[model samples]
Target: MRQETDPRDGDIIEYLDKGRLRLAVILAEDGNKKRYRAVSEDSRELVLTLRQVTHALPKQLSPTLSHEQLGQELKSIRLRAEQLVVNVDASDLWELLVGEMEEVELSTLADLAHGEVSAVTCLSTASLLRDDTIYFKHRKDSLYEPRNHEQVEALKAELAVQERRTQSREVFLETLVKALDSTPDERGTEFDKVMTDPLLRRYMEMLLHLAVAGENATDTGEACELLEDLQARLDHRLKGHASRKAFHLLVELGHFSPDENLFLLRHQLPAEFDDVLEEAAAALVAEGPRRLREALELGARRDLTSLNLFSIDDLETQDVDDALSITRIPWGWELGVHIADPCFHIAFDSPLELEARRRGATLYLPDRRIPMFPVSLSEGLFSLQVGELRPALSFLFEFDDNLNVGASSIVQSLVRVSHKLDYEGVEDRMEHGSSALDDDLRKIYEVADLLAHQRMADGAVSIDIPECKVRVDDDGRIWVRQRRRDAVSRMMVSELMVLANACAADFCVEHHLPAPFRTQEEPDPPMDERDFEHIPEGLALAFALRRCMPPAITSTHAGPHFSLGLPAYTQATSPIRRYQDLLTHFLLHGFLREGRVTIDGESAHLALSQADAAMQSIRNVERDSGRYWMLRYLEETLDQVREATVVEYVEKRGDAALVVVHDTMMRVRVSLTRRVPLGEVVQVVVNQVNPRADTVAFRLAT
Candidate 1:
């Protein structure tokens, strides 16, 4: 127990009402009743009370002044002063003590007491008073004792240490933020020494962990703030190991995709498709030169070199897969289609075969070509170069004058290419009959035309969409060349390939062999036959037809391909470029050699299933890379007005219409204020293009 200190006149005390603190001054005291007449410091209105008062003032006080003089002095002070009353009994005061709220000083309260130091600096509460001494409980929920000067000094010293520590931490945090803004190479030796400190390293590690945890934070704004803060601290050059770690952390935080970052930073694009090349090279090295020598010996090859076989492809084509030869027989003509025999060299279930299966098709890009097999075989030994005797899987067809097949046979044979001609040269010879082998070229064109006409009559759909070829000059300028579409040479080659594939499909079905066949379901009929007639020629008609057709897919069972007008179809061409075509060659060669196919239905299904993922990857690489280069092209020809035709209005993409530039053959999205009818030609100016994001924007020309 402790004695309570009696307050004289003009003393300031805190009145606690429902845990609220109100500072009141004692104007007069009644000794008999032990009560005081006080005026509130804020209101200056006198009131009588018996409630407990808290001593929040200093121990030293001015001598008691007469009530009349006190009232007059208070009125003058109130007129000249700004009122700042701190309610000490409130929870806010407790928050300030624990450093959870803004800092407050006892000196500010002392100034408000107007020279009555005891009224503001005392820490004793009236509730704990006993007898005539004021007391304080050292521990919460404990008995009180008379507060001493030594205890108060010790408490003040502890609070001073905490304030200094807080100020030091704030200075360190500000320095760290400045260091993050500098590039790793630009950061001076001073920063390097500061970062080596153990305390600083611990703080940095803690911040990194906090950023990772924010990846799944419910508040997106909070997550973004954390990422932005961390990014600001990253070194611009990222030369150090820790800087590189920070770069990867920012990437994982979803700031940008890996491709966008690589392009923006001018780093080399990732060669994800090169894994197939690595696996192929390893397999070839393990097999050694002896295996290659054995493959070239052609011990099982049939001799068909006497036939005048020839191949026609693009001037830049390297993998010559199919060749054509024809001989006049008693009925009509014997047509022979020879495909390079890669299946014979690469055995089934071999390492090379597995690698080829993993890469479903060779990816073609503007800058480079990724071959399915090594160039040594695809463009060298196994390629059907002129006058080179190579092993081939030959499809021989005996067709009548009406271009109807009477009998067909596939055999493993050795064929010598008599001549290699490009599409342009073939077209020239076909039109003017100027070549030395004019009769042979003319006869082949006649048969191709008849085959194409018959197939179209059988409901074959031809979508002739032209694509632009991207070329890079020595000085790094991009050029786009639109490929010739629906040319006589293109149709001639396409019809022949279609004829051979149809025969191969018929052979598989007739022999009950298991093979993966290309199939397409019948699409919905057009609203009217005249709707297609109203569409413009060339690319516009092709776009309209493509929108209505379902995508072509491969399946284990043979089905009708409405697009090709074939009841059954299986691709057997381009064995060196496409794995599915190679698989077909393997099946056909096995049947030709052993009188039956070795592949079962289950194996065929597995091949198709495995091929789906690889094929999708190839398509994505081709499509994205092509668009990247196209946008790069637009970057060079900025603000140029180009003629374009509205191919279709895409309703799902909000007010956008798909348009094709006539000169560049580039498809772009145009912002449309109103619906634009299909096939309407319009002028558009390039507004913006971003190669990293593969986006291009166009504005309608006035």
Candidate 2:
């Protein structure tokens, strides 16, 4: 049976393509065979088909435009495109031309429209044809095409879904903002409601996106202004977890205030001294004293408690690591340098030892301190406190009346400090010559003077640069004080400590113990004497010499320390504050107790490497933090004209000369009209302070 169906020209119909209905237009039909010549709306091509045609109804076609009229309209569009400075919406033009043409004619019009617009607008023809709103929507039976009666319902359904989503988002934003403006209790309730609403959750994600985008904005002022505006619109304080995250993002973007506390951020400073370290310290403290007492009762320690041992340090110092004692001998006076024995309790690879190794060294900052060990251990149990019997590593050096070292020996002993004196108090006693310990203090000073002279003769360099101590008081006010470089009390302590370290190093080398040695190679080619010819033999000379010296380094093998005038050197004092010193004590203690070194060369090297890396990291943090605090201090004293020494004159950038301030240890780019010589004292007014960037700027005082 040849059943025939009638379809007129321009009648939109659907044909099967792999079981899916695809839109096509009936361009022509063969009545005799029930075959039709149809053009697909998508491809705009004629095809002969016997497949079933799907249609709702035929749409009434508008009056067809003559070829001349179509050409004129396309020419007008091209003229407008050429005159246009920005992209314009051409949907209205598409609507006027879409319904009046046959499928082949529409295709020709599309090509003309694309070519003319693209030539003028610099848009590709492919881009114009692919845009759904511009060209694809005009096709019959398209989801977006208005002329398709069947697809119009589908378009309305899709739009309704989008409109609902937009409405829900607007309502959520409004509600959240209003809640932020309300009281705290009301705000909490509103926040809970917003978070619980599934429809509003998507908008919350939008807020995050905006925050991240603002953080990454190159224009900081614009970004900050935008963030402030958003905050005002939301009426939120940006205080919760999400707000904190946003704040950190802003910091990462370099948009933070100068006073921002960056050290609180994770990994900004070492974390090995955190609360986890406190746990390990507590465990060590609990068992350490008992073990020391057991060792002492078993005759494992030489009792030197009767000697007049005393420690001298800063007024605020608590970790008394080293003390001095003197006894009269026939050939010479025996000078005993007793260092607190933390290694007696902290075994190698133990939790306390590992924590100490991880910390490497104690960090002292203007505002705070990160101690190598907990105060309960470093300052309490292991400190050589007055009247407390503590185990120590004693270096006994016999010095003749001429202050020449006769012999030296390292011994483990139990000692009780007679007094805990501060540097100022000791200095006062030395000046007045009235204290009970005056004679002993005087003899100590004499020996220190001889030791200094001996080291100077041994080609050792000494830089007597006074350190500027920046301290923050309890009231948070900063004070900078120059520590006296030539104080007799300081020299006495330093010289004795040096002697102890040198003796410890000699002991390690003699016993063939595996210990990390501090070594400094001799300067190559040596420093030119002409560099310091103009400078007086004082601080300036020392500073000039310091610029020529190489940095000291640590290694597993023993080597000479040219700066300390030692054949070999190892830090055995201050075990409470330094890991290397503690490791030295460990090696010495093990050798003394077990008759041979306990740590193998491989283990010593590995530990030394880890300690060296950690120390270097800590030093970097210390330097950066110091600069940060110094800038903070300058912020408080901004615009004040202060006396400063031009340590070095760096490049002249425009009208400014970069100089390092001797007092504050800060580098400043100072605006100057004339050249400034190095070491020239000038008055400078601090013009700007940026603690976040660790920078300060200055202007020459008129």
Candidate 3:
């Protein structure tokens, strides 16, 4: 039965041409094992080898005869296929060929008879019929067809799963809505309470303005005044009476004095909440002396008769950088600002300092912080402590109410801090109408604001982007939360810093000092101002081209930073964490005390090279950390599908794009075709989100 040959059997013919017959033992039973040995080769190899015998065979013989008959047949096969060596079995070549031919249709056989067929053709009539049957089976099994009860059940199961997922999201949103509804009022006098909370002083400062909107009102303003007053009271209640209404009333009624500002800033509140600002100031005053003493032991030199100091960190023995001195001169009272020489004390090659340099600056995170200096120095001896004499490089300038500096002095001096202060305590007195330190601070703020206003008016850009902040509870669960910045906190810090930066920059430039500038440049208004709601493609295209174009001068006045609305700015505060500030301190110290510039043209060139690389590394690290936190935050909030815009798209090869979610810039890989428009919102299904890599992959949902 194994070897029988029939002329009509295609399998038998194929076996006769390519397969070899073998003798073997066969056992047949319930449990049986048999062994057989047979010659086997690839089907393509067998056919090619057999084709070699064509020329040698008789002209009248069938063309399918074996290649061994003719030398010419062997030569032709070798020449045609150099890659494959073809060989045929001695015994079953005829049977195998005949078996292979069994499924060929009669019409195809007739075509072969007419010399119209090629053995190596990719598709055969036999294969076509089989494919059609398979396709038909697949179609019948599809969900739309549902050929059987089991398949129908499976389809229903899938639909149910989708419905449950959607319902889960709806439920989550409902809970969120309930939480919002439970709040008594959206805006409340919690601003008053913030004045007492150290960490929340800035937050309260912003609310106070809203709280006292109509303290003084005209008869014509009653309608508007009543509405604002009601709103203020409502907000105050919602905030749980965070604002101090009685104190605010005093100031509004002109019964408070500047003396009250100083008193309240220093006074302790009822021991209910931990005031971060007062704690920070106390820490500075308490621990700053310790750090300064260490600096002295390390060989720092200066007279300590007049320094004033403060800290923003809770005392934890960290390095401190700022100190101040006030001196009485024959002409007038002179004020000097001094900062610690962290670099000098740290040494050129110490591991601690190297790490600090690599970090470029300290990074402030929501729940934790990464300081540039070790806690020992950042919060301790190097800090300027109240009532403790410390050495410093100070800048003294003579200016009156008009805020013009005439005669200035820079000297290495020793000084002591009279008191520690914070934004909240300061703001409390400012609005409550106090006189303690009001005149001095108000004067200072007026100068700072004037300088900042000039910069903004000069085409500097400042954007007010609100942010959501995360607060954690004691149990490691996320709980209290609020918008990140308020007006008083934002403007006060901004104006003061800008003025200091401008002064530092001018001083450096006048002395031909080289320093890293905190520069902002204006982008075309169309590019910066264009909203996603209706983007102007022409403007976008032009902006992109400009970004790609090289500049003639790499360093030119960017005019006012379109973002900050400032013509020029550079930071000269917070030297402990910010590298620019530390370097500025170094340069200013030399110019003021030694009458010399620290960085000349050559040194500046070298500093820029090192500084640029350091800055890039720091930015990348910061971005990566932020991305990681954001991804984790999203995973927890995934059930809530908040509306978002498409801010950016990263191009990739061959039908794929990485879409950046608006605001966070979290990127997700997505399939792309010519159909998708850039910077347009489209619903997407998130398949995976990885916090480790800070990435998300999604498919188009609609």
Candidate 4:
């Protein structure tokens, strides 16, 4: 159906030049290999390889033509090809040929498209195929492949988006400029005025994304450019990276609150349960009681609900993780540390587990508590609610009066809390007198104090720094409370938790089970009591020994934790909150129940990797959000002289010193205009505080 000519010297050919087809006439053949010197359509001279030549037209022209004549001939051929290009309906040609074959030669396309075989028809068909985005793609040797329906639709969607972006960019920019001059009355206080527009919605979302990702953004798109140009128009002028600029712009546009919890967005910690995940959680919550009842009835778990178990937490605590019970055994004391077992319902790598694993741990912010599990389960089923039967991973420790652990064992159990006690209530009872459970509380504290002394003898470095719990009320009021570490209730709870974790780690090691063990390498230079005897028990002194303490790591291997004074340990408490602890429960529960592996060593390490990736972000969001609220509190107390103690000089960051506010015990960095000795208390005035930016600047009041 088609014919073509071998190029001697005068034939014109269609060839690829920078991915576009162009008409070029052969000026001379270079050698026996078919390489030729040719003049392109624009009369540029170049050597053409055979691979570059799309095809040779059957028509020939004079070989010894002048450069001007060659240019004229090329232009005429291009004009005819372009005119014939309009006649080739590419979509129709695709419809005709798609059912026939996957790929077709250029001459076949020409015959199908124009009902004839000629240089003009071939050139026209190739040009149409190259230019059309939705129909076909160029294959090798002048073969063109028609995209399938799905591929064509995908290309059409992409091209449509590109078209919308190209068409909307200038228009959106114009609307944004108009918005800058718009008064509050014109748009109303509600941001729905601007968010109603789809383009502006995308623009604001991109701004949020850029602000969250900052320099780590994989692609800034035109968001930064648009922001830069907006700032340029404002003449209110800023410089440097556009992330901060984006944040300020959102606030200016009234799209974001001044005290927006940006850390939540920046870290992308989930703030609410997704619908599908929430449904799964509801199903699990509905099934939880049945599972526990069956386990208890079948004697699969220890029925310890009859024991006088007690839970101690803060007054506002709902998602309780651990409860305590104490009873005297014949040989020694038996202390039961019961923990809420969320993994009893959560399957391995299930959707809820995956979400919890990605979340790393429950996040406690000043104004919000982002629960790792949905509230349907976390605060309801999995929480050790008072007087309710709940599944638990219980650790029983048998110890002598000397605080010596004689024997320790872990078991899955069902527990009913007999009493719910707050830290203050427990501490009040311990300090004064109580009518009920006085012996149990005192015995537990006695064991805790004795255990602490034993740990001190074992070279444990105990540094208890008081924390500030900041809360923001619905009325925009900030409350900061000094949480003391010296409370008897807190101290005994801490000691017992450490003991349970140590025993759990020992259990894993004894059984040679793979669990998430928390280990810390020894400090380069060990710290002793002498490091603290000189400094007062203030901010820097609290960190005297802890400063040298290495960070604890969660791994599948058993190792010594220098800070805990334990040869090996793992964190098995807070399974309701920490995914690592959930992983531990899974490993232990599987082994203790079926003597089989649910999460093997490889899977434990994989969960550790996934949790590690999100744990740092979770921690960063926690600390940063706390600081944001603390700064907001201080913002209300601006220009007030507050006492701050210098913790240490942060030379690595700048000429600054970290100081802890005496009232709140919240640590912040202050720029040093004069030398300040470590642990030196100074009066400072808060000059400016922006919680959104997490900036609090202070100067010496003296």
Please provide TM-scores, in order, for all candidate models, with all chains considered together.
0.63, 0.68, 0.46, 0.72
How many clashing residue pairs appear in each of the predictions shown?
12, 0, 85, 0
Cα lDDT of candidate 1 equals: 0.66
lDDT of 3 at 65: 41
- Tens digit per residue, CA lDDT, model 3, 25-80: 11111122222111122212222122111111101222344323323333333333
**Residue 657 lDDT in candidate 3:** 55
Q: Model 2 Cα displacement at 220 (Å)?
A: 15
lDDT of each: 0.66, 0.69, 0.43, 0.81
Q: Point out the worst 10-residue segment of candidate 3 by lDDT.
A: 135-144
Ranking by TM-score: 4, 2, 1, 3
Residue 554 of model 4: what lDDT? 82
lDDT of 2 at 561: 92
lDDT of candidate 4 at residue 660, scale 0 to 100:
76
Give the lowest summed-lDDT range of ten residues in model 2: 54-63
Q: Where in model 2 is the C-alpha error above 4 Å? A: 1-260, 264-280, 287-289, 537-539, 651-662, 667-677
Candidate with the greatest TM-score versus the true structure: 4
CA error at residue 665 for candidate 1, angstroms: 3.4
